[model samples]
Target: METYGVWYHEVTRMKGREWMRRLTLAQKPTPLEPLTRLGELLRIDLWVKRDDLTGDMVTGGNKIRKLEYLLADALDKGADTIITTGGPQSNHAKTTAALTKRLGLHPVLLLSGKPPEETTANLLINKLVGAEVHYFFPRHPREMDDALLRLAEEMKAKGRKPYIIPVGGSNGIGTLGYIDAYQEMDQQRQEKQLSFDFEFVTAGSGGTFAGIYMGHQAVQASSKLIGVSPWLPSQEIKERIIDCIKDARTLSTDSVPLSGEPALEDLSIYDQYIGSGYAKPTPEGMKALQIMASEESILLDHVYTAKTMAGLMDLVEKGVIARGSSVLFWHTGGAPGLFALQERWSEWGGG
Candidate 1:
């Protein structure tokens, strides 16, 4: 089977089967555009894979790619309701709700944080889609997962077939989405005669990074995949990514034997950009957000893409990324998150 630029044969043919199981939601092969102005400022050949425009306004973002596979699995299992967990303003949860509603399936979101007094951003969109949302102040992050499973059981007992999706859809099944994405990217590169030295992406839940890394590995590509940590520590994100990769390998219809197990050395994760905490707006991140908006009319969310851009700029400034080397910044999309941080926007006088 041929997809994007990849001609799947043998092991890749098995991978294509996994992708064939997915239901289409995203506008496939999102634009790969040159950030000419930003590239000039940084003195590098910089480009962007616009995953932000993957879906409609509310359903747009990187999460939609994962949801295509996840929701398809839910339907295959005869699930009538979907249960997922994420932060209060999670783009994943919002996209899940939007897509689930479109498919005529119920959505139950177990969000980690206190309910806001005034609904806005993702929370507002969730309500608009009529998703049943529950909030919990967990002592540990694992508690949210626990709550999701328990809720699914309760729904099952009440005669509803519920499917549980883990936080950020960062599981073996969802990771396949990005494996397909890598193929799409390679197709674009071949068509444009572009050569990328590095590919930078945000490592939030690790599935996106894992899939991209494994996709590159599957194709034996030379470009280095650098994951910028937006939430977890570098070590933790690395572990999660490795785990996801292993899981994906096992789930594939056929295995491609490796000389040795992929190790930490095989992956590159930078955690320096995660200033303060996960959702907190860092000064550097805010500046990066402003630059994209001003120069390219591209909106980025404070939680993910902004921090990732900040890391990219910092690496360029530090001489880690050479001036003439080509770089591809994967835009994962979380622009609606900007509206969720009204107070921070006011404090920065961005309004």
Candidate 2:
């Protein structure tokens, strides 16, 4: 079978066509290094991929990589306004606003979570960047999609060009961003002569997981990609991610080609750290935030990244990996949302 990823050359050329066209992006090959103290604590040689430093103006996260392609497409289509929806404290929405403002595109953000009492960091930033905020009562996660579609139709009726980016940028096109990260790691492994036993990440919308899964399959990377699910059961997350991978594989191949039923055995999804539900931060996640910051001076958010880090720590403690086995933890930033719960953080001694 032909390889299932874009070359850096192709990745650049593809950037200026279709949705990827007109998408010039900032540099974001974040440093991957060993977390010596935390690794010692867990008895594993743990590493961290610092996506938290990936973008400018606190738009830090794995989402910037995807936005590079997404916004390019929007501009290519001559979109005047960018409309995206998410929770009140969504990292994705906040980053979308920041990037849109930086590129001179109008931003319309729809928020669908609890209304904050004061100006939380994300809310403050959204207003500072002049992105319109629309609120909705906290409801089932599925409601956000309905809201997004309805708003798109309304914008269409008004004759305004709107580009709707799915929550967390989970679609096939955006998922390609993560696949590019895999390519970066492949090059890093060669340059550093690192034998990465496994790659770890917080699995939120499954786009990141799907990218790593498809990239590994295409490049035959030796590292195993393990997804720590912040929400949803392992089985359900795997099914959703598998479907995304299938679609992405088709996109990469330019058509649906012969395949062996989405070979995803190397993908492991663990759901041990999700305490209450989506958006509900856990005590363990809080502790992880404290521990990582104090030990490595690395900050982790409570919602997804810290929870996934907590799971990685647990896996290390239980010897699920191994002593001295190299593992990379992908930090999918949500730190701005940290201020949204500063009171909780102070109470829990997380400052």
Candidate 3:
């Protein structure tokens, strides 16, 4: 029942059965540790927000922050079953299943693509959670969305209450998660009297970055917010993030409304890190993953953090981020995704 910061009104006042409520799912204020080894190597004062440690290895990840709000809303509505959709290795879907089961709600996941030959990482976690999963290859992403909606309708006809969560829990309600996260980080900054020149985070479904952006503007923080995309092109990713901010703005005044679609000068999101595409590992991405593991003894997944850290490294070295700058990387906790790409484990330019 304790509110973190600015978004307390934004989150608890949502139109629902329990208007003022939030399920305490993830650990509050994950540690912001200095990356001494990586900092010396990169010639920058590097720090990592260990959001990856928010939960256990199986269910721990950034997704839990968002799910805390979303699942709470579902429970408030008295839903008996929760329906959600995502790719083969969606952290959000895996978190949803694990937590929904914990709350005594049936989790039905509509995952993209046929089941893999070996169920690893998130897929393995999905199975362990005993979630009802259906795999398919949809011609379009919207097709999967439609499938989820139709499935919910069918469940409703069968006298079951189904609560549908969009991919990545990337909605206005879910955006509250990262907003609170950003507030927590700000609180840490004020307490430690540390000033970060650049704050870097993985820009995937857009909600996480948007929420952070919202919180950044709300608190008038001076850290330069940058997003490294693991998916979507530059323009498309910008649009998605803008849409998320807009959605959040509708629910609360904390988010600054864009006037005439202001240029994204404040928000610097780059698609260059995407390398190939989502979930596909690149040489730089793999090398970055390996570097973090070797230098800091911290593991990063090939899908998300690997590329994000890769981009941050390149920017720092290229003098774009400045050599002596203080940098912070938001580790969004998708390391388990490495097991799914087992065949290419050593293909990141390693002998």
Return the lDDT, model 2, position 40. Answer: 86
Model 1 steric clash pairs: none
Which of candidates 2 and 3 is the stronger one according to lDDT?
3
List model 1 lDDT by residue over 133-152, tens digit each: 99887654467678888998
- Mind giving the per-residue lDDT tens digits that candidate 2 earns over 1-351? 012122122244332242243253545578878899988887777878777778677655888888877876676677878888777888989999988877677888888865677887888999898998888764644576788888878888988888888778777777777787777877776788877888888888778888877777667767777888887777767777876676666455322233565644545888878888876888778888889988999888887998898887777778887888988888878888888887776654464
TM-score each candidate.
0.91, 0.89, 0.90
- Residue 246, candidate 3: Cα error in Å is 1.9
lDDT of 3 by residue, 151-202 (tens): 9998999999999998788877788788888889988987888899999998
Model 1 residue 198 distance off true place after TM-score fit, in angstroms: 1.1
> Which lDDT value does model 2 have at 237?
75
CA lDDT, every model vs. true structure? 0.84, 0.76, 0.82
- RMSD values for the candidates in order, in angstroms, are 4.9, 5.4, 4.2
Compute the lDDT for candidate 1.
Answer: 0.84
Cα miss at 302, model 2 (Å)?
Answer: 0.5
Model 3, runs deviating above 4 Å: 1-20, 253-266, 348-351
Scanning candidate 3 in windows of ten residues, the lowest lDDT window is 1-10
